[model samples]
Target: MPRLMAFDYGTKRIGIAVTDPLQIIATGLETVHPKDVIDYVKKYLLAEPVERFVVGEPKQMDGTESQSAQHVRGFVTLLKKNFPAIPVDMADERFTSKMASAAMLAGGLKKSDRKNKALVDTVSAVIILQTYMETRKF
Candidate 1:
């Protein structure tokens, strides 16, 4: 079965997550440099069947689009232009980074480890995917 992929987009890096083939669990896949994300997804597609994409929709506390959202939408446009078959959706991403940090602390990560942006990105992607999944019917 095809799986769903999620991305937490940032200016410098993008965190990725993918569901199991059964679509039962979402797992953190990797953190890729912004420039390398397209190539990375291309390579990943060779091994996994991805049916759809879930991108974090950056929003401010005031319910306005965040400045970074433009960059994310740009990425989504490029993604659609490259892979016209797959559908893309966006999920609210407010507080995901803070949630990731709290999760890391609860997971007993060391102070140094908790400070790793890459790790936070990956965890944030997982949270996004999981939240998206929770809203789905299946």
Candidate 2:
């Protein structure tokens, strides 16, 4: 079975996570510069069989599309264009960053580590992947 990959796209960096072949567990893969995301995914595809892509969809408190929605939509378009074989899906990501920060605090991470936005992004990607996995009927 092929794995499922998830992305938390941001202006400065993109966080990545992947599910197990059985789609059971979601694990944080890496955080890459926004400009390097395509190359990174290409290299990763050469090594791993990813069947699907999940991207976090940012929305405002009122459940409306946020400013970052356009950026994520563009990123999704690029993914669809580059990896036509893989289907890209979106999941609501209203409080993922806050959740990630809470997780880091609970994990007892150092202050410096907690201050890293990239770390938060990576964790958010993992959360997104896990959320997608749990929602699957099979």
True lDDT of residue 8, candidate 1:
97
Put down candidate 2 lDDT per residue, 20-46, tens digits, no spaces: 888889999999998899999999999
Model 2, TM vs. native: 0.97
TM-score of each: 0.97, 0.97
Q: Which window of ten consecutive residues has the lowest lDDT sum in model 1?
A: 129-138
lDDT (Cα atoms) of all candidates against the true structure: 0.95, 0.93
lDDT of 1 at 91: 96
- Candidate 1: how large is its RMSD? 0.8
Top-lDDT candidate index: 1
Question: Model 1: runs farther than 4 Å from truth?
Answer: none
